[model samples]
Target: METLFDSACRYMSDSELIYEITNNKKLVTEAERQGGEYDLNGLFSSLTPGRKKVATAAIELYKRLQSRHNGQDAIRCSQDIDALIHPFLWDLPNEELWVIALNTAAKVIKKVRVSVGGISRTAVDVRLIMRILVEASATQFAVVHNHPSGSKHPSREDENVTERLKKAGTLFDICMIDHIIIAGDTYYSFADEGRL
Candidate 1:
């Protein structure tokens, strides 16, 4: 026989719903959500009861995950990326959308690009990125591309895209972690470097 707790979890996961139980056991709905069960108890156990604020913790943890990353799944650590590009030095320039998908742990679930092409600036439709991130069901995302000019660099264009996407993420409640620029093996993190 299925237990009531199991049924509740199942229903919550399938419907992307979370139920908050009060001290008196009154159930309150927080927000609409997707993905499977989150270890809410385990994640929160370390916090003192007086400070265990579920909603606040979830948002902050999401930010912290993107703030500290190896860039291995999302980016590699060996290269700074900014030091690698030399668009003026090369005849053929290419662009790529670097991405990282994360779970509740703030650990990467996967990394991917939505598009890659010329000039690093030509594409990057902010609207398009919204769909791609949602399709992956990512709760957070980082956008990145190379300058090809070896600058470990971000341009005026880059800043604009980052801002637009950040606002979009906020609107959707999807955490916009950070943006990165990769050239060769080098990487620059927008959040860590404080550019974003």
Candidate 2:
């Protein structure tokens, strides 16, 4: 199968420019390794401002194509959540928490980025999360956050937040499905581990 880089190159108007942009070994390796989740900054850092603009548009188009191809399928398992969410959280230098609101049948209703924080930690506001769930009319939801330090282990604070959210969801008859900690391609899912 042709790699994603090769496929992306075919869409570029100038093959030579794409070749020059992708000339760096690190860029090529990372792009090939991560598929749609590769680092945008690293990909464009060496390019001129004009080239960066072209590259940014190309990347945005690529992401749209990828998401369209993937579709918004039901979340059946932790792996499904990982595949659905990796593109959003991957390549970030800091942490971000997102909520995936699901309908009664488990199909995604919406994805909301709840918070963005420094390298190690981000605060989660339960009230804000509850408000979003209520507004979306979601019957079930999963919370996901990235670990920029590349560890999948949940901290004590992560556990506390998960417990609190689970309790809060009970009051509204909404379900807290899982808490996923993503680090690059790997992830830890509380539901999968019997922690939820």
Candidate 3:
């Protein structure tokens, strides 16, 4: 049987197919940045039946990459946490809250995008954080957010959120590993400074 890609390619001019594939590749690069399960249903709905098959294949590929842990699942330090999350924060112009769920071994189970907002701030509800932790059965978690302003210092709000999460995590028997403020290539760790 012809593959989904082959079916879709039959309907597109060579140039149109090439252009669409290129754009999908760009989307794949930014998949984890979505901060949640990347939903491609809407994108597929907009295409012709044949094209939808192609989009589905692309979406499946993206999902596999987002979940692929390789041998790097265990987070060894703040730097390891930074390396895991940095790709998802790339080129993000606005603020976004990301939660990394971990097993007892410090191996990442998933990365969740809790919220996204204006350039200056993104609101995070501890309840939502709790929900994800419970769902993932995560024994430990780390929080990371970016500042487009290129300053990695934790703001008053960042400290407040860290404290709140720490208190809440304590109640759930879930340890909050660290709260990281990422700016460009640099990062500040709450745990590193004895803040968490």
Candidate 4:
């Protein structure tokens, strides 16, 4: 019976294997000694040389990109829901629903995973979605859930969820622009289909 902790450790171990470019075996050995609790730098220290600089550069580049969007006034971004989902929904497994919360301007303030259910059809409760949106103080939102079937078409359940969320968003004064279903490299958007 592997616990969640074990699963996380497994993911960490796999990451090490995938990114083992540096010969910083000392870092790996230390992390191994400590049962795999290495800080970002400590983990990076164990990488082989080329990967170290590459990884570090990647991080710095990401930081710069994040800085462009980090902590900005929400009133400026009013991004159409399709714009956000199109960039990230592809290739995700089904039963994983992610929400993009936005400020008044429709700019994304946060991306949250509100649920992890079955790979086929997960039960989606509207209240759970509402709760997170409210907690985040988001004024608008776009929802994206993967299908795992590699079909970007929305099912009846997906349509229902979108309608329900739209109605619910009205109550919170949060606009629900679109609900996207992503599978493999394809994606479907409710708004683009004139459903929203």
Taken over the whole model, the C-alpha lDDT of each candidate is: 0.57, 0.84, 0.80, 0.69
Tally clashing residue pairs in candidate 2: 0
| Superposed Cα deviation of residue 27, candidate 2 (Å) | 11
Candidate 4 global Cα RMSD: 12.1
Which of the predicted structures, 2 or 4, would earn the higher lDDT when compared with the native?
A: 2
TM-score of 3: 0.66
RMSD of each: 19.2, 6.0, 9.4, 12.1
Order the numbered candidates by lDDT, best leading: 2, 3, 4, 1
Superior by lDDT: candidate 2 or candidate 3: 2
TM-score for each candidate, following the candidate numbering: 0.50, 0.79, 0.66, 0.58
lDDT of 1 by residue, 92-124 (tens): 367777556555445555555577677655577
Minimum summed lDDT over a 10-residue window in model 2 is located at 9-18
Model 3 spans with C-alpha error above 4 angstroms:
1-71
Q: Which stretches of candidate 2 lie over 4 Å from their true place?
A: 1-17, 20-43, 68-71
Which parts of model 1 have CA positions greater than 4 angstroms off?
Answer: 1-93
Winner by lDDT: 2
lDDT minimum window of 10 residues, candidate 4: 73-82
Q: What is the lDDT of residue 112 in candidate 2?
A: 86
Candidate 1 lDDT (Cα, whole model)?
A: 0.57
Candidate achieving the largest TM-score: 2
